[model samples]
Structure formats: structure tokens, C-alpha cells
Target: MKGFAMSTVNIYKEFTDQKVTENVKKVSVIIPNYNYSRFLNERIDSIVHQTYPVHELIILDDCSTDDSRMFIAEKIKTIKDIPIRTVFNETNSGLVFSQWQKGLKEVTGDYFWIAEADDSCDPHFLETLMKPFDDEKVVLSYCDAARIDDDNNVIRENCQDLYNMFDSRHWDKAFVTEGSEEIKKYLSVLNTILNVSGVVWKNIPGLHDIFEEAKNFKVAGDWYIYTKVLEKGSLAFSPKCLNYYRKHTDSVTSSVHCDIEYKEIVSIEEMVAQKYELDMETYRWQRIRRSYMDANVSPEVKKKKIAWVIPYPGKGSGGHRTIIQNVNALIRHGYECDIYSEDDHRTTDEQAAQKIDEFYETCAAFVYVGANPRAEYELCFVTGWQTLEMVRKIPAKQYGYFIQDYEPWFFPMGNEYLIIEDSYRRGYSPITIGRWLANKMETEFHTPAQYFDFCADTKIYHPIEEIEKEDAVCYVWQPEKPRRGSELAFRALKILKAVRPQTKIYLYGSAVDAPVPFEAEKLGIISVQECNELYNKCAAGLCMSASNPSRIPFEMMAAGLPVVELYRENNLFDLPEEGVLLAESSPESIAAALLEVLDNKEMASSMRAFGPQFMKDLPLEKGFAQFIRSVDHLVLHTEYEQPKAEQIYTRAPYKAADEFRAQALDILYTDEVSSTDAAPAVPSLPRRALRKLRRIAGRGVRMIRQRIGKQ
Candidate 1:
């Protein structure tokens, strides 16, 4: 806090743009006090202890209820070098501008500074700010200020509100611009100069008239008065934060909405536009600035865009689809969403966006080929494990993970898995798809996590009463996706076909045709409407997951198709058993669970009745609202109540059958099945488990594949 003021080193600088001149300027300092006794002594010290001395100092106490008058009298006694006066008002002036009017009557210097009693400035504030007056056109000179607390700790080094309005980065450096230019661009945009304590104004004739006219309105009088002052001459600004503006916890205008403020803001906008003859572009921006005046409405945070870094998506990629869906949701809620794609396939941004619109839902996000965007985002989301590195290179105020799955399971327990784990260790407050992924992040990685529910588009994947049910089953078998458990699901379908040979089988959700041992129809890459029809036709659908359960099962249940998934912690925390069945990881268990749903009509009827009922509460809109609330937390720089992770799936998975209980048997043994009909999924289920178990046990599964390939 000390030794960093401009006077700590040297106050003088060589000026090339403007002529450098030395002058004896008479500077008057005014401390307008009202119930700020705690800070009065320090405020007086800051003004009197300046590197450049003041010509006169006047401390005006506006009948403060606190002991400010006593303090002001005591403070005046210590100021021996400068001529100082203490004026105690008979009545408390209700407005700050009234105090400014009262103090201006006592000012005898050529330049006057209305230093608020709650704020303090550096020793070189006078020396630095007074120099700009050497140019006769400079009427008011102000330097950048640090926001400080009553305890004098710096909240922020430089006030960023100066740039937030027009994003004019003049606060980053020193400049002297025309006063009318200031009024048109900045003052019209709602007081971009911010604090008056940072300003030293030349005590020009008729300045009192500006304050008297300005004080007619409350809440925006400072802004209006600045415009009036700047109209007289040029405005000078130094970027060095030499002034400290104290913000109190109990500020009246801090969180309250005032109709006077809103109305006056609109009035000023119109007045400035017409007075300066501002072009339509500046006038349009001035109108947009009125939204910030509504305190009850959402803050400027909603105006900031959220950026996403995602892997280059393929057609029919559900992960990328979910990312785009939420991006569109945000856009609908008044946030700009820019999606950066990491595509090594040399895909153009247009091509990638076209593919997204073609395969996934239509998105309103701006799609870019690389991670770098032109503007820095307020919050950037790294959409997956693959794009974490790419998102790191982006410029953002905060970075987070848009986690859909427990991505470590997407790969084997090796290099990529370890890197994904480290990505979570980067301590991103991840916004997950469901409670299970959020719970995993909070418990395992110890990061703050937020979740939106796994909602199916009920209107699309809904019941079609015309389609009659068949003694059939469908499997989501995407071989390219490791988390889908394609091999496990494929084996389960084989056993189901073996048990009841009359059962029709179908596989979908993949574009590339691959060979399967079982008898089934491959309806490769069905549309959403076609998927709804398929879900209605089948009695059961198998959607297996080794990680967080996919939304496919939810959609199936919504369409009255009872779904079966592997019983794991990932599934147990989020998936409900009403329309979904959780089975142990084996061919026998999955086949048995599918059979259980098909065989029991009473249970199937209950699932059909409740699946959509449950989905009613978990619509895409509800999930989107929750996501928006979590993201708004980032935007407002405030944390909502951090709730403990609660488990939704309270019941354990259905018990594994007692048909195959030989713990000491070798899991590495690979048994060959001659045909789907030849292999009975009966008491020989123990032998049926051998091949899948070998795959789980590792090397033997690959060896058996090698042997089959040779044959």
C-alpha cells in the first residue's frame, strides 16, 4: 500500500504529444463530509500531505450525525502549512451535489477538487493531475482510481467500470481529449469517469450554475454535472491509479433500484445525444446503456458471452450435440455463445457448423475452426477432455469444464486417462450433465460442481400409440465410443436371441457398418422421429455405459421402452429404476434384465405410466434453467448455496443371479460359441460369461480374436 504512489519514484514525465510547461497553479482541496468520521482524519491527511501543496483547504461538514464536526475541527489544527477553513452546515444537505455547491463558495484557488470525505488520494495526486492544466484547454483532469474498503485495503488496483461501458481502453493510458468528445462518447454513456474524488476541476466562472442545475435530479447528478463541466474545455486523464475511492458495506445506492436513477439516466442519454448531435451508432449505444440502471434485472453479466472449446464433431455425435444444445439455450437466455472447435480433419468452420445443424439440433453459436477467439470471454468452458489443452490457450476471465461424462473412462487406464484426471485437478468448477458426473467431480476431484439433468426431448422421443409392440429388443452399439460398452451390449443381445429365438433384434446409432455374430437388423443412423418409432415398437432397449449413463436410455423410457444399463456407481447415482433397469456387468445379467422387463407385463405397464410422468419434471427447459443459474454464478462472481451431493438412485442394482457362482474359476479362459441357437443362455450361462470375462481380464480376449481371425 505504501511506496507505490507516483511521488514514490518521480512525478515528472517528458511529454511529446503536448507542449511541456511549468506553472504555479493555485489548487484548492475541499473535503465534503457527512457521517464519515472514521475516514475523515485519513482523508484530511492525504490532502494536506501532498507532494504538491494546496493553495487552500476547506473541510465542510454537512451536519453529520456522527462526530465529524469535532474531527474536522481537530484535523484543521494539525494542518499548519496550508491555510485551512472549517465550515459546519446548520442543516444536513440531502444530496452530495448540494455539498459540492456549498464548498465551491469557500474555494479561493484557481482549481478546486471536491474530494469526498470517504476517499483518499496519493501524495503526488496534485502534482500529477495539476500538470494537465498547463494546457489552457484542459478544464477537468482526473486520474484512474483504485476501489478501496474503509480499512484502506485495495479491492481492485484500477476501476474496470471505466472500460466496461464502451470498452474504450483509454483508462489503460494517459490522454487528453476534447470535452465535447468526452461528453458524446463517455459522459453520455453513463458517467464513465466514475468517481469525482479523482477529478480536479478548474474553478471556471459559472461552475456554480452547473451544480445548481445538476442537483435538480438525484442518482445521476454527478454524471450530468461531468458532462456540463467537460463542455467548457478538454478532459485530461492519467491511467495511474493515484486516487482511492472507498466503498462502504451499507451504501444506499449499492443494491437498491431507484426510479429517479432510471428516469434521469434516460433523460441524460437523450439530452447528450441531441446536444452533441451524436450519430445513430452512438445514440443507439446510449439507449442500450439504460438496461444497466435496472437493479432488479439481471446485471451486466448476462451481456457477457460464454465461450466453449469442443473437439471437432462427427455427424451423429451425441456429446457435441449436447454441447450445442446448451449453447443454444444460453443464446435464448441473452448470452452470446461462441464455440471453438479443434478439428485436425481440416474441416472449415462452416462445414463443422453445417454438420452440427444437419446431425444435431440447430445451434445459434458462432463456430470457429480454432480455439482462439477475437474477444476474451468472461467464462470459457472446455467441453471435453480432448479440448482442455486447446481451451487453456484461450483468453478468458474464468475457465471451467462442460463435463458430460466421467471422461477418464473414455479411454483405457493409461496415458489419456491420466491426462483427463489431471484436467479435473486443474480445479475447474465443472457444469456436468447429471448428478452422477457432478457427484464424481465433487467427491473424487474436490471441485465445485454444477449439474443439469439428463433430459430427453419428450416431444420428439415420445409415445406413438399406432406402433404395436413386438417381442423385440434394440441395442445402442456405437463401436467407436468406448464408454458405450459395445462388446458387452453385443454379447447381451446374442444371449437374448439364443434364449428366445422368436425375439427380433435391432442395432442403431452408428454410421459405419460392422460385423456382428447375432441375427439383427442394422438401421444405421436413424433420425429422431425414426428413433421414437423404434422405441415404441421394441419392448426393451439396451443402452450400456461404463461411465456416466447416456441420455438415450432416458429418451427410450420417455417413449415407453424400458431400458437396461450396467449396474455401476455411475448409473446408480442418477438413473431411476421406474423406466430403467440396472443390471450387473455380464451377458447373463443384461439378458435376464431385458427378459424381466419383457416377461412382466405388470411392471412394464408401471414403467410406461411413470417414465413420462418423471420426465415431466425433468424437461429440457428445467435442465436449462438450472444450467443458467449455475453459469450466472460465474457471471455475478457470487456463489449460490453449495449443496452436498445427494444420490437420486437410492436403491441398489438388482442382485446377480445364483446360476454362476464359482469365484475361483479362471476369467482368462476363452470359450467359443458355435452359433446363437447352439449357445443356450441357460445353466450354461457360466460358460457364456467366459468370453466377456476374458475381455474384462485383458490379454485372452485379444488372443481369442486373433484365433478367430486365423480361422
Candidate 2:
């Protein structure tokens, strides 16, 4: 069966944009034939039936003893459309490289394909292969291939993976990149661009010098030529297996010549390392290690691991709970999991494991912050803004983010805010908790986010058997954390109590033993069971989250209670389901909304019923299920360096921190600007505070600089 796929290269330019270079239209096809007269007719037929037009076809015979001379002479008569050229050698050239150099001397075309006489291809081979030349930097482009016997019976369905054994399956996907990047990563160790019969490269001037150099090696001539030509420019790769590579008992490559091929492979790698200025020691070590692993390692015995960088898990922290859940889910999916906490030097791995048992009661592996275990992980999850620093210190093949919330808004618009904001722009794929954060991350920041919506554990937080309501309203209040909007919530509650003097108010989630001109019950942090019971006792509940929709709102809905929240993008985008009331972020708007729920019995009943139904489709396991699926797909399908979109903040201005701080203070304190020619001057932080902030911020700046340098 033949497979077809359009490359990432846009096709309009190749056919209709009229900006296509004339070089792209001119393709010189050189067929080098030996004793394979039986396969010559099939090879010629495949090239003749191409969907894309070719400029010329040259058939060179290397003193073949078979009837190939008579067969080609008769077959050349039926090909009436394209320009044809033929070369017959008086003596056997003995080397295929000689025939190639001979045929290239007589050809004049922008690109060339050495279509071996024993191979066959799909009609779309040239059409797909030539698209990459539209990029002037691409020196070569190639496709995947299938192995067939002399009778055209399939031997191997896809052989590209067999060649790409050191790295992951890079050839299974399509990419267009600079040759230097591809060379240093994948090509430095082995020739992943396999099967010259399935390849095509540009007819650049200096390329012939590399061909002459390749004549030095009898076994790995193609490998030498590919490595040398790539040094000139970029390359394009297609995963479509369109070429048919014939393998027979008498094929030249059938016998193993390990000693010679190994020496040549090392020599070519050394040349590539010097050309790209790669670390010679690292290159040699990696080459030897990869060769060892390729020979000794088996897929069944391979140890797969996933690491997580998280803050120490404490009670009542939703983010920590989410991390534990993710670890448990990954463990269930047959991965050994590791957790690294920040600034924990005292606890050993066993002690950390004991702590996890006390809190989450799971058997997943644990690693202390400074333990520094030795194992190669397939992926690492950077769970917070600070974790990016930890990730910078760790080594992993693939990196991702478990963005629980947008942490930048947690601080005022200052240096800390800008630093936290910069963490999202570090080019890691983010799997956010809700659609609101996902959309915000993807659209505003231009970094794509995979959204995983959450659902509650119905078994734990279910409605009571009998419906009952008390004369009190409850609010999850934490005055110290300003993002909870405690001051605004208090004002709204004061207004709410004045109108309905008979009902009582209850505050929970924090212990604020401060003075207030109100009477209420304050329940300091309660357990999951107690919170569910409190929801059943209250007539209405209020929870405020300015950054992301908190889990408490869903918990309240699950317990069959009506909830009131601020109508912000963070909430509106995620909690569009019924059973919740959204009010503008004002005391008056919130008080009116609470009154509407308490005053009408019919609306209350409908909201209580809508809560459970809205949450039914969202089972508690759905988020983790999606999370594991995303992790698996990203590890197997995506490139090591996933493509990054254009960033939003071009001039982030963090270097001028003092000026930025003063301007931010001006904007925060003063409502209007003065009509003066000079810029307004605001007070800066104290000298001691400035020094401390700089010391903390210096690390982040260096990290950003290092990241930029690598790019």
C-alpha cells in the first residue's frame, strides 16, 4: 500500500504562488544500473509515471553482464514525454560512486536524485521530495522507505526506525530546520537519513567536493556525503514512506563489515563535531554510550520514569493535592514516579517516602531536593514558577508544565510579577487545570496549553440523603491572601446582613482573630468531610478566586448548595455550567446576587439540582485520565524541541527594575498624569530592600540569559 501526506511546507508556492524558483522545477534523475536487469523495467516505470514533472532522466550502465543493455534500449523508446540521456560504460567502473560522478558531469539541473536501478517509488515521490527546495537553505530532503525482496514481497514495513536507534523516533514526523541543529543532535552519532535511493539533494557547487571526499570510504560513502552537504545549509525530512528499497541475498550491504564501518562512522562524526564546534568529549562519550545501549538494551526491560518538581506537600494546599493526584495517576499508568521538593536538605529518600505515606498513602518513589539521584527520565514536570529554576538544574529529554494557576497575578505589578510572567514564556508545553487558564496561556502568551477540566470525587463529596437548610450563609475567607478578595467579600457580607437581619453568617478556611463590626462563626481550616457537612448546613455559599476558579466552588455545588462568585474571565470561562451565580466584582453586585438566591425558593431548588448534573459528566478520574494521555502523546509524538510561537512581551524591561518599579508605583498610587514635559518621579524601594531584591532577581536574569544563549 502507498501512503501520501503533504509536508508542513505550504503547497501554494510550489504550484500557484508564482514566486517559486525555476531551480525547483528542474530535477535531474540519474539511474545507476548494474546486474539488476530484472528490476530495471520496474524502476524505470516508477520514474516515468511520476505525478510531478522531471527535467531529465539519465540511465548509466556499469558494464552489466545481464541483458540490461538490450532491455533499457527497448524501454527508452516508450518514454516519449521527458528529456532522456543515457551513458554506457566501456569497462566496469567497479564503484557506484564512479557512475554517480560520471552521470552528474553530463547533467544540468537545479536538483539531483540518484534513483538506484533496483528500487521503485510512488508516483508522488518527486512531487513531495522537491517541496523543501522552496526553502533556499535546505541542501537536502528525504523520505522514509519500505524494504521489499526481489519478488516485490514486503520484508520490512518501515526501516527508518531501525536506522534511528540512538535518539527517539525523529524520522516518523516531519520537520524543517537548520542543518547545524539536526547534525549536533541526531546525525552526530549515526546516519538516520537512510536509503540513498529514497533521497534527493540540491545541486550546489561545493557538494561535488564532498562527493570526491566520500570516494575514500567504500562502505559508508552515502553517510559521508550526507554529513558534508548538510554543513552548507538546512534540511527537510518527510515521514511518508514512499520509496521501495529492494533487499536480496547478493546485495552489497547484506554482509556485516563492523570494523571498517565503525571506524568510518567515528571519523565522520569527528568531522561533524569539528564543523559544528561541538564538545568532542561529550560527543565521543555519547556515541560510545548510544552504541552500547543500542546493542544491549531491550524494549521490554527498559525502565520508564517521569519526574515532578513540586513544593513540599502541606495540608489544605490544593496545588499540592493536585500534584499528588498526578503522581498517583502516572504510577497507575506503569511509570516510576519521582518527586523533588524545594529546599529540603534534611530528609532522606526513605524519610520523604514515609512523609508521603502519612499524607497520601501511596507507594510511588520520592527524591529529596538535594539527593541528586542518577537515572535518565523520559519527562519532567515543572509544576510552578520556581520549579523552572529547578528544571534548569536538572536534565531530561522532554519538559512540560502543570500550570495550576497564573502565579504572576499573585504579586503586585513589580519585578517579581515580571519574573513569574517570564516563566510561562520558557517554551514548555503547559497542561493547565482549566480551559480559562489554557485559553489565556495560548491566546495571550502564544504558548499552547493542553486544558484538562476537573471533576469531583462523587463518592466522597455527595449530597446528604435528606435535604435540609439552616439560617446561616458560609464563605471561604482568607484575609491575608488578597487574591481571595476578602476585603471586598466582607463589605458585601456587611451589606447582605443589614438587609436580612434574621440570618447568620459563617466564615471558614482561615483563622482571622481580628476585630470586625459583625457577628459570625469563623471555622478555621476544616477537613474534606467537615466542609461537605458545612455546605449542607448553609443556605448559600460564597467563594472568591481572582486568578482561577477554585475547587471549593465545585465542592459546594456537589453538596447541593447554591454558590455565588465574582464574574471574571477566570471564573466565567470555566464555570459556565448552571447552579452558580456570577456577579461583578463589587460589594453591591455580590450582595444583590446573594439576596436573589436567598429570597426565591424556586431558583434555589433549580440551582441545587443543576449542580450535580453539571458535574456528572466530569468524573474525578477524567482530569488525570486526560493528563496521562497528554503526557504519553507528547513523549511519543512531539519533537525534543517543540516549536514555539511568537511571544507577546517583546521588550519585557526587567533590566531597568528601579525605573520599572517607580513607574509601577506611579501608576498604582496616582490616578492621573501631570501635564509636564518631564517624566514623573516616584519613590523607589529602600536601599537595603533594593539590594535584596536584586540578589534574588539576579539569578532569574542569568537564567533568562542562559536560555537565550542556547537559543
Candidate 3:
């Protein structure tokens, strides 16, 4: 959208209207206090005034130096309806889960709610939560709780808002799903059950053992407990916000990134996956969880000023859009970023900034058209293959590459290829956009590299309702860029047209080519909004790349469009099978795969449903967080290990030797020209040089493959 504005989600409303006295049985309330004296009185009263009867109330004070113990003692004397018991520990238990275990041991009832001393809930909180335990299989039940401050002002409307990264329709309403399903679908990624103050658990057998295991984790113990406890039975949720989870501003913004806490989080995630035999998406959800964690961390030191030496970009290039998006992300983190473009633009700073705002995002980056920097930068990052040399020439304390692709693959097996490969051997640190690139750098180039997850801006690319569906395929047709497989797509679309002429082909993301060899509509250079519209209406999307996968497939899937791409090593690590079909690298194979999506209604519907679901876990903001952390480590000189990216795909890459031999000749030559025929017309050269260097590559199939094999 030209005038895109981040939509404000104001889900806050006073839900003080509903009342239900639906009672099941005795519910034990545990109040664990430390130094929360001011909130203790309110916390005690919220538990005491529960609409559902409390069989017993246990108050455990962990050596509070404040007036918490005095407030607890005062409240204990006034309690009449519930059996009140108070225990004041002489020494503070190092772990909160220790307090949890002690309180659970003292519970006389079969159900317990651990109400943190700092939190306060509504009068009907217990009654509403207790209603779900009517099913014996329901081991856990919780409701949406809004965030509050010490003044009782709601800071956040609902905890469900945290789940927007993975799911939008869930946790907003009541649900009764199997505990295993909840763990696999929701909790396995990160802790979907956010705050423990909102949950009520049934005291099933072996619950204490889980609690004992939770004691091993200091920060994520509550999250561990939730995953473990859900193994006992089913889960029940209520959307009503009768619980108020308190948050002190000092505690939130003052929080620092704790490495131990993160280790525990991933460790528990691995544990849950192994226990359930779940198909792990490789920390996809944790990217979202880290955003929640990173949001809280207030870096004390200012970030080093950065200069992203970018190539002068055309209006809607995906590469340029990604660079601008990252610049915007850094700006939000208080880093001053400058864009130093080549003099090709021949524009002033104001014009450069205006053009960026027009073409890409509304960037806050200081845009300068020339390579000479007016101001010094602590770090200079290169955004493309063309900028690496320029960035190296620039004076900076640090130089790094924000590589989107193995640029060498964009060229043939010649000087251009060697030049791009040599760029990797440079001393500058590199951060790639996806794991496969990282894998290449680390395994081949032997440089430890970090890569951010490939994700789409879900808010911008998601499915738009009321769009009429069409039997069309939207091809990511970039002609000038040879890696985009212009010739391959032309042949494939021709094959598809011959088989199913009714199927329409829409070419986009590039300028109009002199007339492709098939029946297709050339809708080049569309807006972000228009791209999403194409994604929504089209049955399938084609982004034929022989190098690092572009952001197109992710965007297509984000808009609920099934995608088709070449089956290659570069895509195997990042592209999810649910959203994309990795067709064999041949025109016939590509056409047949496209046909499957167009003709098979069951498969298409399944793909459409799964694409959005897969992307919901990998929204753009999540990718931003991962990138920020990667750079933060670089700038702050922090020690971190980049996770080794491996392929989730098990299927072998399909080899098409005959098709390759023929296509290699097809690309370099024309059909047999007779003596009467003039020289073969040369209009458009190959788009993105084919990574055809494989069986068709050593400069020309067996040669390139032989060289690659030798290397």
C-alpha cells in the first residue's frame, strides 16, 4: 500500500458484564508472595472473593522484607468461608517452582490455582475457569488475562495478543482440544500458555514429578510445567478476561537477555518435541518467542551507527524491499542507519529518501545517493554482490555482508562466478537471509555465519477476503535476472498451456518482456497490495530459482497461495513442503506440478489451508527479531553460536539428465536453421544466468557438474 499504516489493535474493553456461578468442586488457591506488599492485599482479596467456593487457601511468603507477611497475616484472620493456612519461610526459596511444589503438597482439593502475589483477578475468575473441569479428561483450563500495572490500569488488553505470531483465531475464544494437540500445534513452538497466573490445573497423579523436573529451569520453569502437565489430559480455554496479570514497567523494560533462560527454553522445546514425536519446524516458533523476550531487553549501550551500502534499486525489487525493511527494523531499535547508494541515481539526499519511501517502505534511514559518506559509521554492511567491493573500500570499524543469495550462482562458471565466490573469502563477517546460505558459507567458505529465517510480512501478504478465485497461475517472472529462470518458465508455461489451455498464466515482478512465447498476461511491477491480490486469486504461484530461494514463495504462501519451485539444495532447508511443491528441474515436470495444484481440488485446498498456517508461525516481525539479534551479536561483540541449518526435506533432488542436455543446448542455441532461414533472432538474452552449470554447467552440463564434483 502506498499509504500503508501499521493497524492499531485495540482489543481492550471492560468485560465486567458476565457472571456465572457454575461450580464443580473444591478448588485450592495458592498465593506465593515475595516482596509484593502493595499487591498482596488485592491478590488475597481476589482469591477470597472467588464466586466458586475455595475449599482451602494457602499463603506462602518467601522471606519477604516488605509488608507482604503482615498483609497475609491480616487477611488470614478475616477469612471465614475458606480454610486458610499461612506459612512464612525464614529463607527465600531460590526457585518459584519450589513455592509451587510446597503449596501443591498442602492442597486438600483435586484442583489448584497458583495466583502470584503480585497479580489480582476478578471475582468470577475461579467460577468461569472451574466450569471446564466438569470433564474429567480436562486436566488444565485457563482464560485470557489482561496485563496491568500497580495502579490497576490495564497495560495490555489480552494475553492472546502474544499468540498473533503463530495463530490469530486461537486463544481468542474458548476451546476444548486434546492436551497432545495443544502441545504439538501451539505449545511445542514456544510457551503458548503464557502466564501461569491465568491457569488452573487438576491434581492428576505424577503432577509433582513434573513440578520437580520444572525446578531445573529457573526462567522457563512455568513453561516446562505447562508442556509436561498437558500430557496428563485435555486442555480447556475461556476467552473471558477475569484475570489481571500484573507487570511493573521497571521489570519489563529493564529486563536483559539472559542466555541461560534462552537455553532452558530451547531445551524444553526439544524435550516436548521428542516426547510427542512432533514434526519440529526448527525453532520457527522460538523466533516469535524471542521477539517477546527481545522486546523486554533494554540494551544499555547505544548501537553502533551503520551504513548499508546498497545498489541503486529499481521501484519494487524484492532485494531492495528486504534491505529497506531491515533498515527500518534497525531504526526502531535506536540504531542510526544510512543508505549509501551508487551515483547511478544522481539524486540528492531528499530525493533518495523520497524515492525509497515511494518504492519500498516508509524508511527512516538517512539516504545518500553517493558512495562517499558525509558521516562516519561504526559498521558498514553490504546489501548485494555489487556493493561488497564498495563497502570494503569504505572506512569503518567493522564490515559485514547481509547476503541474500550466493551471488556466484547468479553468474556462470567463469570470472564472474569466481569473483563472487572470492568475495566470501574476504575477512568481512557475513549474515545471510536464510540457513542454506549460512550452510554454504560455513561448509564451503569455512566462515562461521549467521542467517535469519526467511519469512513474509504476514500483515501485508496474508489472504484478502472476498477476492474471486481464478484458474490462473502467477509466475514470479523476472526476465533480466537469469536465476529467475525466464527461459525455463517460458517453456513450462507453454507445456502447461498445451495440456490445460483454460489455465491462465500471469507474469509479474518484472518489466514486460518483448512478448513471451505463450498465452499469458504480463502484469509486471505491481504493488505489495496488488501482489497479495494476485496471490489470493491465483490457484498456484511459480518462482523458478536455481539459487537461494527468493522471498516470493514465502509471500505467496503467506497469502494462502500454493507455490511451485525447482527442487534444489538451496530450497530444501527453508521451504516448507506444506506451502510449496519442489518440482523436478524440467519444464515438463514444472508444468505437471502446476497442473496438480490447478486440477487437484483436494490437494489445492489442503495446500491453501496449510500455507497460511505455516506462515503464521513465521511472520515478518519474527524474522526482524532474528536479524536484529544476529547484528546485535556482531555489534556488541557477544559470543553466540549460529544453529546449523539442515534440511527438513528428506526427498532426494530429482535429476533430469536428458532434459538438462537438451535444455542446455536449447538455451545456448536455436532450432535447426536451414540455409533459407536467417540467423536466429537475438532479442532477449537469458534472464538470471541459469545455475545450469550442473550436468549442463562446467561452462557449458557434464563440464560444470564435473567441475562441481571435483571441487
Question: TM-scores, in order shown?
Answer: 0.54, 0.48, 0.52
lDDT of 3 at 310: 91
| TM-score of candidate 3 relative to the true fold | 0.52
Residues 1-711 of candidate 1: C-alpha lDDT, one tens digit per residue: 333443222212211223213576888989998999998877887777677767899888888999888877776777777998888889988888888998999999999898999888877787889888989999999988888776766667777764766766767789999999878767776677779999999999888899999888887888888888888899999988888888787667533345556667767876775576554335435435644554444444225768889888887788887888788777655566778889676789888777777878767676788865756788899888889788887888998789888888878789999998989988677898888888888788888788888898877877889888888898887998878888777666666666676889988999867666567888899898999999899988889888787889888888888888888988876788777888877665677788888889998888887787878777777778888888888876666654555766666675434442112112112243424344422222345555454344333334544543443
For model 2, give the 10-residue run with minimal summed lDDT: 647-656
Name the regions of candidate 1 deviating beyond 4 angstroms: 1-302, 660-711
Candidate 2: clashing pairs of residues: none
lDDT of each: 0.76, 0.71, 0.76
Relative to the unseen true structure, what is the Cα RMSD of model 3? 13.9
- Model 2 sits at a Cα RMSD from the real structure of 22.7
Q: After superposition, how far is residue 550 of candidate 2 from its true place, in Å?
A: 0.9
Sorting all predicted structures by lDDT, with the top scorer first, yields: 3, 1, 2
Clashes of 2: 0
Off by over 4 Å in 3: 1-303, 653-711
In model 2, the Cα lDDT at residue 9 comes to 21
Query: Which is the better candidate, 1 or 2, if ranked by lDDT?
Result: 1
Q: Which candidate achieves the best TM-score against the true structure? A: 1
Model 3 clashes, total count: 13
